[model samples]
Target chain A: MSHPNRLNINVENLAIGYKDRVICQNIDLKLASGELCAIVGVNGVGKSTLVRTLGNLQPKMNGEIQIAGENLGAFNMDQLAKILSVVLTEQPASKNLRVQELIALGRQPYTNWIGTLTQEDKRYIQTNLKAFLLEDLKQRKCHELSDGQLQRVLIARAAAQDTPVVLLDEPTTHLDLYHKVQILKMLQQLAHQSKKTIVFTTHEIDLAIQLCDKILILDGKTNPFGTPSDLIKQKHFEQLFPSDMVQFDSSSGSFKVKK
Target chain B: MGSQRSYSFVFAIIVLALLLAFLLNVSSGSVNIPFTAVLSGMFGGHMEVESWNYILWNYRMPKAFSSILVGGGLSLSGLLMQTLFRNPLAGPFVLGISSGASLGAALLLMGTSMITGFTVMPFLNDVSLVIAASLGSFLVLLVVLLVANRIKDTMALLIIGLMFGSITSAIVSVLAYFTTAENLQRFVFWSFGSVGNLSSRQVALMGAIVGLGVLLSIVSIKRLNAFLLGENYAQSLGISLKRSRLTIIIATGILAGGVTAFAGPIAFVGLAVPHLTRQIFDTMEHRILIPAVFLYGAILMLLCDVIAQLPNSANILPINAITSLVGAPVVIWLLVRKRKMLF
Candidate 1:
């Protein structure tokens, strides 16, 4: 068990949605340092809304979100950015930006007003580039990258940001199975080695079960969050989807189509 | 390393083109001043032909300078707008700022005569035309800023800007319908766009205002680069979206409004130069693109102005027509070659 003081993110009695409507309420979750947590749900179950609210990209209707024991709303953009970095699913507006340039943007919070990278900043960027195995793609424009390559670059950018907590929304949306597993494994390694709290929302329940330290399940009735084995023992995956389409096999800890 | 070499090479070519175009603009007017006379006049040396000295200093110098300012200012504004809206097709005029200027100029040239029954107000002359245009553009800018605060969707804001443009154009058309033939002709000529009409004092004023806009752009380079990743990503990166958006709007208003006030809504430079710069330089970094676009825009405008002068002929083409004629083909070629949206 982790010490209570090591909690990186703590949400209590939260309700999240857009513009006067509430999607889910009575939500409580605590993420500790070095934990890789995955939020899994069926489509339209407010996984994105929940993730966005945590990232402070959307307004939370009613709740308390604490980052490092400080109120999430209290920190300004700059303060919040120092502690939390996010990688979103949206395509970049300009695909003509080079890979190195895109990665350098991670140093924006540390850069001067004119955005000139310092020697220390350049060193961090270079380290992240090597860590992510992106040395060969540094000169390539973002538009020239494959989906898996771009995903790695984005993750590398987040790593370069060097925040304690990193949030991602569907980081593996458009990749093949092998690439998807590769990205998840890389993220897991990042969380464990760097002692950063990595939280992301994904539809890959099987992969999340295999790799993530903990899982948050949003299934319309109740949002249950726990370790993958604990959630499986609690029959969380069985109620994830309608029985007509898929069935959870407790023995294999995976889901299968109903015949 | 290869990219750095290419960037320097492209910068050199653009600088060479700008200098050549500047010389061509100064020396190839109706009374062709020889290159030596233009050069001597520029350097403050004695000129053999007295009138050549007068023509180069008093007339062609201001015109050429205004062209450079207009070109640099308008293209930079366009680049800012494209980044702000995240739409490749967005130009400085997409916000209806120039149309608002047109409305103000139309009201002065035609509306006053109809309302007061005076053929022309002595005060409502060339200087006043610029003032009216500036006032009009700033008014539109304020309204757009107000709208921008309420709307988060850039596409929605773009549509609202178009609607504002439509409303202003409709009012201008009504004014045009009621005015006399002489007043209508004056309004039409103003709309035709000329870089050579302003005196040196007016050019200085335009330059000062556009310089402030350029300064704002330089200050906003970090925000602009963050914005290329889309608004949400930018926000998550700890960027204050509201502040960045407002800064971009004000900077664009100053650059586009200042140029339109003096240059009569010169088209295509704002709409096409950034695209051309991106194609030539092959990168989207604002730090590189801003200076590169400024130089390319100055060169393009000077080249267009030289062509419009028709060298040694008294009859000159309207600058608006020349820009479109040159700019439209480049845009078409870009479209045909890419066969897909660059954005």
Candidate 2:
């Protein structure tokens, strides 16, 4: 496709990694506003790293990220929070905190010194609670909630943040298939309704292919990104699973075994 | 869903309970001042005008006010640390600040010929203790921060704090072993915690430190809330994890330090009050949680002080003894409940 218009993200020659170990380098990428993107890769191939870097969750090496033509570092915490929100995979250790209380944390950027939720902020929080089907569990403590409920609660928190970009890492992990589909559908609706850029990393390539507007593929080696169709056409998935037992079927755009 | 009215109703009840507790605190001392006398004294009148005035002005008033300040400070600090560290058990004492103050107090009591000699003012002997406590609290906080930068896990940080407390306790034990019996008795008395020992000026200074710390914590409520999501998530929300962490430690220092300096290491208020507030408020939003914690802590400390005066003659119990009598049962209950959850 032609270069997507309204691209708000620009990363140049980026290198990202964890402590003492570089995951990926020499990366150049751009993300358009309102685009729904899924990052797909084999295990340990740096898909999460790249998405984290783009989310400004991790520091970039030897390059810079520009969001809406402004450098990422130029935005202070509150300023950046107004633009981007992130949901991590780890559950918060705050067991006694309730669902609604956790969601209100998203409105932290908008609160004053004492962190009181404004009426409008409360309205937004309520909307997310209902949208996420968390109204019944509003008073339930986080530890009492199941993993699926916790995931939804966190997603609701990100929604309450009202940012233009929302990034999640493995939002579907620890979820059953039914809840997984529900979460993906919610994210899809979010991207369309809020016109927010939604970026997430997942291993469910078939589900991503069916749900995501675009898919960024990373093999164990070169070429860390591509659309689902493009990666299939390029045959990048052949080496991803490491075993010849599974084949990347082109017709149905799904994975199947040779058994 | 419960109506907003219910939330406000709960809040109103908490406020009323706090007021009642404050009144009881002002009236239920050894002198058995009447409610009317306490109220009138609060509004600039003295009932007896002899010992009532002396007792109200020189004794109970400052003691009660300091209790309120220290109670609020300790619990608020506990709430901040709990959120910042993302651990439910994190508190000022758990992080070694209280022990640090205890160590400082031990040093001051044992190191000198006279405890009052270190102060700038002769009349304000406890002034030296307050300064010494603040210094020690800050020193531990600095160490905790340095170690925190290296240690990433919340559980590990809690352990580090516990280890620090143990080390301080060991040092205090060694000092106690070397000191004279009279000095040791004084140190031991200070260790058991008391709310009535602070003079008027010392109370004022304690108020100033605690007020400053609590005000700082209030200002950082947004940051603290962000912290509940973990440090990385907080950082993404535009809060610097380092800055938020430091603010929490300093707030904790003032709370634990001031209390230990004057009250001599009050137990369980920091550990118990935050959890009590969380349950009472039914929400973890710091705006609600902080105030709830403050009120609950004030009530708890006051209740302990009241019980400490149970003898009513010359046999006032140590505040720590009363708190442990109350707090130990609650802790055991929590443990039992947690064990029941395992099934």
Question: What are the models' TM-scores?
Answer: 0.93, 0.90
lDDT of 1 by residue, A171-198 (tens): 9899999999999998999888888899
Q: Per-model TM-score of chain A alone?
A: 0.96, 0.91
Range of the 10 consecutive residues with the lowest summed lDDT in candidate 1 chain B: B1-10
lDDT per residue, candidate 2, B1-343, as tens digits? 1124246777788779877877787777777677787789888875765788778778887878777887787888777766765666667777887888988887777755443434223332666787788778889878877787688676788788899889988988887777778778878888888888778888898888888887888877778777777777787777877777777777777777877888888776777677767556666666667777888888788777777877245578888888777866775676576652110
Positional deviation of residue A85's Cα in model 2 after best superposition, in angstroms:
1.2
Measured by lDDT, the strongest candidate is 1
lDDT of 2 by residue, A1-259 (tens): 1123566667777777887677777666667766778877777778778767777777776577887668988988778888888888777756666788788888878877767668988998899999999999998878889888999999998888888778899999888889999999999898877777788989878888888877766653465465677877887777677566888888899889878
Q: How does chain B score by TM in each prediction?
A: 0.88, 0.87
Per-prediction DockQ comes to 0.54, 0.48
Off by over 4 Å in 1: A1-5, B1-6, B112-131, B138-167, B180-183, B341-343
Instruction: Estimate the overall C-alpha local distance difference test score of candidate 2.
Output: 0.77
